[model samples]
Target chain A: MLARLNVALLGLLASTLSFAGDAISATEKQPLNLHAIGMFVLFVSMTLGITYWAAGRTKSASDFYTAGGGITGFQNGLAIAGDYMSAATLLGLTALVYTKGVDGYIYMIAFFAGWPIILFLMAERLRNLGKFTFADITSYRLNQSKVRTMAAVSSLTVVCFYLVAQMVGAGQLIKLLFGLDYNIALFVVGALMMVYVTFGGMVATTWVQIIKACMLLAGGTLVAVLAMSQFGFSFEKMMGQAVSLHSLGEKLLFPGTLLPDPITALSLGLGLMFGTAGLPHILMRFFTVTNAKEARKSVLYASGFVAYFFNVILLMGFAAIIIVGQNPEFFEGGQIGGKIVGGGNMIAMHLAKAVGGNLLLGFLSAVAFATILAVVSGLALAGAAAISHDIYARVIRKGKATETEELRVSRFASVGLGLVAIVLGIAFEKMNVAFMVALAFGIAASANFPVLILSMYWKGLTTRGAVAGGYAGLVAAVLLVVFSKSVWVTVLGNAEALFPYDQPALFSMPLAFLITFIVSKLDNSAEAQAERAAFEDQYVRAQTGFGAAEASSH
Target chain B: MSTTASQNAVYARIRKNPRFAELVSKRQGFATLLSIIVLVIFYGFFMVVAFNPNLIGQRLSEGSYVTIGIAAELFMFIFFWVLTAVYVKRANGEFDEITAEIVRDASKEVK
Candidate 1:
């Protein structure tokens, strides 16, 4: 079975290469239009203006970090969509479904399934506890310094991985859509994202995300509608055509079955579902809402919007499969004759170009660019907040710093983080964006999620426990991922990898939880009785959102 | 400590109000149970798919004739919305009341 799967994959690869060659030769003379560039500029300008307008209202650290906690449910809903729906969702999933059939929907299922966990468990508590960062919650009962250090490290790690992925994606999208060099695209996207985040903070970043989400959904839906219309509004016919042409069989709907093993299937599922809850960028959005209820509402809205958008993307992918398959000339030839042009990420863009001409193509391309920018900006902000607010003000300075000073440091951190991302993006431009994303998710799940879950529910959870658990998860996940086949072979170009593990969830997550549990048991009496009482009071306050209101009333 | 106990009493009173208690108890259980069922059914379906990939594979080429795959996908979408609607409703009613009670209790403690 393994040999057969390998042979089949190789065959598919050969066909894909040929398709790429054909596509490149056929579209070699097709130049990018200035009209697309004009539309791109107009869209960018509008989003930037909104961001700038919002930034003007940001007068304090709270405003800079959480938009003064004034974002409406509807507005925050759109921003949530913007933040969660990245270039990967817009393009990669569409392309995957286009090429691989049902396997593509795995991404959608995993992404959406994680929301319930967020809604029921994380969102409200997160909103009520820490003002901005995950560190706030984990470090609540523990020593603030230990919490800050672990939280910052985790946030930075996730943000760096996520930013690099978005940057790499931006480079690819620019090359495909604008016919520009990958390096130029990466540089342009990096600069734009840095400016938007550094200048506007959460306020600007939120609006930019909202605009990007709207465009991606609209653009993706339009293509799906067009594709369905071509099939006389029949999804069944589209699937039929896909299955007939591709012979995807059960693998179309049940992902990893195509991989010749159940372990791979489970790994993919775990990665998608658990990874969503742990993503730093996604988790940070909980802090943007005013209250726990609003936070819950935001998740509901985000889930609904994301599910709807993904359905449209699913249709778009099926459309591409049928449409592109019907016309083999559409395939770009590389080392083989049947492979599609670019990687799996280019399917949606190619579909737009196929159906809507260069104008639609350009529009979608610009939306893709916006998608990368919005995601990276949010990531940069999270990284900055973790450093400035969580570490510097709360931990290092021991809450002595003024709000003004904190805001200054946060803005500076944003700039620094953005520059770091730009450099990394340029450096790793050739790597797969999805791998970077997966690595971030792995780290987040192993390190942050355990710390978050344990701290919120476990009253006995001590500072030592959190630190031990957090660092353990962080180190274990990073080490496992670095040694995994995907990173070692794919990213580092080393065939002989040390560790056989591809997914770190089965090991690192449990290890982190175990370490935390043991440490908490040992440090049970370390916290003073008075401090323990105060901490219990804080937990109730955090859970109820009464803490802040009670403080203000006093 | 006595002040905190008194505050807790008032909170318990607010929580124990017949209408509020009934609503809170019913909705909280309902939400929790519904969420569990949704997650179970969602994962259960995936588990089935994992174990039996051929369940929907045969219907792939059936073409607009209401195949199992299409039905399953539609069911999943509907299930998702049902869960969302349940959450929104319960959040507005039971969860909101509990939060209000807690807020009131905390405020009294401050006084």
Candidate 2:
């Protein structure tokens, strides 16, 4: 059966690759960008060296999953920032700001708001309770097999959706930036991701992320400083120029120009906030630290870096309006106000070239590609943990799996997930897959966030209630996304969407919470009583870290 | 198994410690308050955008080119980071001290 599935996946890849080849050649051939390719090759070589070093030390399951839990707070914080800031944030967000003006900043504010809440409520408890995956916490006192199965399924779902989105975005962005073929880009990304995760495990993944974060920070600072220098480093002067040059003029500085309605605004805000907390990859970073102190520090550093980058993007976006938007060289056929050369997302790249020439542009392009690889590696690691730790070790083996066996399973799972991601990225190349990110966030918020949070805080939560509520949220989120306008009308060729809102968090998240609360209140089983009785033990450990997993010494 | 039993005993004793109770309650209160502050600030901005966006779009002064919205967002970007720093300082220093004391006491009781 597995072989058959592999054959099918390969067949699909071949068909998609043939069509994509034709499609690419039909368009005007982009000249090969030697500078960008050279920078990216240097980055790949450095990360592979780190992976070789990390592979030597990856000796056990703990090392594979959480890097022996030996990472310091500051290093973990940088890694977390790397995981959160994907290529989308660098490119898509800048594009949003370039086109929509201040509306992009508003979107960014919603995204950054989640970090403080995670620190305040979830970080310490998560560090204290979880050992490897977030499932370790949710299934702590519940029926291990049942609750873990649900958690693993939901986690894998979130991981797969997020991975596909990153893979597709990586393919398209690399093609545009480095003039690399889409298939070749996907293959390189998938192969490197598998190598990093299957060999170096979380140790290599964390280092890669930290390195990428620094490079991204440095690159962004250069672009922002160089571009802002043109405006005399004056925000008022930049905004005034942007306002005069932009089509929207005065309205570009406001919020109403972005979100069409109140419900969508609130829903998008809530999804981005809680979704950060619920993401399996982001949640997994807490365990890489030593303790709650490190976890909290990580969140603080992550939030600071993320917010600071947004401020940088704010400058780059406005600068691009003047720098890239006004320059005919960056636009197609030297049309100054018409479509951009490589599309809207290339505004930041164009601005880089306009300010610092080809050197900065090549550097930023490499950074963008590195950002995607780091994020996908994190996601793949999280997915592997869900499979090997939650499902295989805890559920299937019934806690009987040895460390070596679990480690073997994790490597295999990482390779499997990497292959699946590549295939899906290629197959979905011609389709509109931007909504997958939103859907992933919706599922994370509705399915994973509610159960994980409740298990930590509420004593009344039972196995049945959690499984039921989690599945409900998962199903509702997927169903709503399918029926929403983006998928229902645009992708599926339907006449009208059944769901009015593009974001399902406003409706589905509440439904999940209400169902979980009501179901737990109604449950009166003896097992429910036992789970409630066990909460005190979990509560104490969560509060003080008395019996929490200690960092393993080498 | 015996280690797990002793661990549970220590956890039970820690749960009963007055300091543990104090730590949980104090931390919980602070966390809840901070979460509320963040939510209100973020969602409040959303509400304004939904209902009265022009208010935020208005300039800071007659001469300044910066809008009230951008100024407010810039303030929030820095202010939110400060809030996290504040929570971290208290939680890592004061609350952690209490936690360490409670755990030490509870382990002694179990022994």
Candidate 3:
């Protein structure tokens, strides 16, 4: 789910420039692609059937929260893969390789790099600690009411930014793929996501993710295999072709295409690498497994699938440059039209047709839409957890809320979140997906990550430190982004940016850590002492899984 | 579990267990080493890019045509994955054995 927002970021930018309006109008004039619609229909029927089965089985809060800890390692791995691959990935990363060349590989590497840290430091501990939301771990031993409130706000902030990016990207993507109007596309995705979250909960969400992962893996491999047939399966020959055809020539094989600025590169790197550990939706997936060991195993499986998937897509991107770049059929005036029909992001889709014809195009288009659906469901579920489980149940009710009542509120929140997403989706329809997601990751890394990591590893963290430090990071990230080049100059049409740097994580992350440390050191009150003293047990629970919550059998 | 005081005592008690000490040291030692390796490899790329972004485009060997940076990144990617596999393998085969032993010894004392 988080992975695909990477899809929206570049897909819209590149695709929108090439034949954005013309394709939208053409798709409107013609009926939707029948084969693509048929496959989508079949996938929908199967998933809804699974949701029906899951709804009947989802009885208790644990069932809704963690799927009763029933998912196998392989299945959880697939689910994590599903959540990891998003519309942004499908459309954006491919386009980056097709256009930017070697620099685009930075994103692919950064995305995978985080999983190892998660594997080594957080995954086993998280599975042992958090039940429904990652916020659970952040507030595990702190002053529950205050810390959980901060967690809920931080979680909701990240989810909203991510959800809007997905919704907007989906709205534009379906318009080009299915020829459906943007509003209709948004409504269909929003409604379906609500159904999966409200009725099926985590059970339905996990199944959808698993299904999408398999489909994506199958679809990506087919494209790569076909592309390889051109070069007799020679990786070296393929790279040479991309380098020769690329406008940058040999330079295309090097790094620094996206963010060449040293400070910005460092900042963006920090954000993407650490941000995965704190994303509410991704962390919540750990709870679906039976134990910490299973959690470790799942990351192992996910890393393999993700590594294979990105590597194959990287190959296909290079292939697109060779296959699609020379075809003036995909260009306007003998050059890729940034505002025409097939310029930037659609290069991969066009290359699919160039290599495998219409059948592959239909299959890929269907996979793209399915990825958006799987991603939105995961985000919606996480958002509802923050609202119903963290805010309404823990903070407001002061831990007196009933399980049934929390579950009911969770379903209700999903529907509400869907409505909000629809409105924001339309509002940001023309916004760049990459910037939206960067905002999400930046806040996640600075605000959510700092507080959670310090709380888990540091012994002196207090309630005030967590709340104060978290809000400081959150405000810094958002405020810096608002005044930075990506948004301030480009979108807002300002002459100059208030913030010289685009990424805030480099500054904001340290600020949050520093504030938390200083405030914690000075805190010697009775409550602060207790919270600090509680860390020794929390450390043991996190490490050995001795007193961690057990899998429910009901 | 419900009260803060009781939870604090739980950790203090576990701290006294020799097995818990063994589990923490061995696991954290290996983890810190792995984390340093991953960070160095990733940040090493960032530092190179930060100083000389164009250095990445330099030809790998006199006439191969593939950039050195590309080859380095692919190597880093594969190496990072291998490191993770190695860590999980050890954690399951060795670290986990220690964890189980620690939990077993500590549980009796807590009760």
Candidate 4:
């Protein structure tokens, strides 16, 4: 089945290439600056070196899984910031805000809302579980094999969607920022991410994330500060300038102003908010910290940093609107939007170039590249961990595995996953990367979030129920997204779409929750009782970190 | 059964720690409520502006609205930090105690 899927995917790619005309040719004319290329290389080399050094001491599975459970709150905090602040947040949100106005704030609201939920509900529990992946937590109370299967499926689904989005974004971003061909750009990014993950594992990924987070925040802050300085640091004057440009109105105060309708806006918001807690890459970060308390502190720090950085992004977006509106000709010939000029995503890059010149533009572009690298590496790690740790080592091997053997398997899996993502990136080169990101989030929220939430909170949740719920939500959401008008028209260039709903959460989420509950309730057996007891014990241990400490001490 | 008793005893010890006891009694509940309140207020303000455009429309240009929106966003961003600072101070003073008690109890089980 997997082989068949790959073959079909390749066919789709070949057809897309034939129709689109020379995928590689589009990238040949614009050679990237040596300085920007050098900066990217420097960052990647440093990250890889640091990660390799860290990996040397990782002799045990625990070390591989949770960085020996020694990560500080502040370091973990920065890592969390890195994990959350993907290219989607840095590039996509900034552009959306610039183009759409008020509807852009909806993304901020949805994204930040998930943090409180994480702090209050999941952080401590996840930290206490002390496993490398979320499957350890969800499967603790159910049949191990069944839970692992559900987890693998959910993790793989979310990771692949996320990976494709990041890679596509990378390809487009490289072309826009550095004027590189899409194929060359994708290949370069793919190679860099593979190097980072294969050598350093979590340590390299975390450090790179930290560095990228710092760069993104610093870059955003500098732009905001510069833009404000131009306005003499007077908020009112900036508003006046903006007002003069006719950029403010009812659209700035309402949800549906930018979107075509309220339902789609609400769906977008739902996906962003619910998707945060469900994403495999983000959830896996909690396991890297030492304990529940550290996890909580890390989230607290992340929330603080994320909120501040987003504010700067909002400022930059508005600055772009006012500045760009005043000088439309400045951005007239750039290949963005429909005419290949001044698309929303290019606002930040264009702003940097206009305000600060080549130096700033080059720096910001490097930061954007790093953002893609960090996020893709994390997603790849999650996919690798899910495959090697959960599916292979735990289920297939039945817990009989040597440390060296497991590590080798994980590294190999990382390479394989990276290859798959690169291939997918090449295939879907023309699709709007943001749409893929939204689909990934939607799938995560509908398919994974429901099962994860219920499994942890509800004692009656059975193994059968989890599997049923997970697969149902996963299949339904993917099918709905694939058949939606966005995919058919925007991605495949097909006018006719089979699915009526653009967002599947309104139906798929409830369907998942209902099926899981019903299935668990109908199951009655001694094994079920045992499963319930084990789950309850795990929850109790997780709340207190008793079982984890015991295992670690041994 | 004795092991379960010891675990319960550890829980009791955690409950007996004054910092833990106080945190459990008030701090977590308060932080959770405070976050909810802030979100409500923020969303409510948006609702008001969204429902009654006339109130915000007095300001000229979509750009002015964008400016105001950005300003509000900046304020909220700072506000989250203030909230975090307050939480951190309280957590260090109170929540840390509960956390310490739990860790202490877990350490005892390990030994």
Model 3, native contacts kept: 0.65
Instruction: TM-score each candidate.
Output: 0.88, 0.96, 0.93, 0.86
lDDT per residue as tens, model 4, B1-111: 112666645555554556544645575586677568556755554554445434433444553444344455556656655665566666556666666676676557645
Give the winner by TM-score.
2
Once model 3 is optimally superposed onto the true structure by TM-score, how far is the C-alpha of residue A539 displaced, in angstroms? Answer: 1.5
Which stretches of candidate 4 lie above 4 Å from their native place? Answer: A1-31, A246-257, A333-342, A492-501, A549-554, B1-93, B99-111
lDDT of 2 by residue, A73-92 (tens): 89998999999999999988
Q: How many residue-pair clashes does candidate 1 contain?
A: 23
| Candidate with more favorable, higher DockQ: 1 or 3 | 3
Docking category of candidate 4:
acceptable
Interface root mean square deviation for model 3, in Å?
Answer: 2.0
Q: Residue A495 of candidate 3: its Cα lDDT?
A: 97
For all candidates, state DockQ relative to the true structure.
Answer: 0.29, 0.74, 0.62, 0.26
User: What range of 10 consecutive residues in model 4 chain A has the weakest lDDT sum?
Assistant: A334-343
Q: Distance from true position, residue A552, model 3, in Å?
A: 1.6
lDDT of 1: 0.72
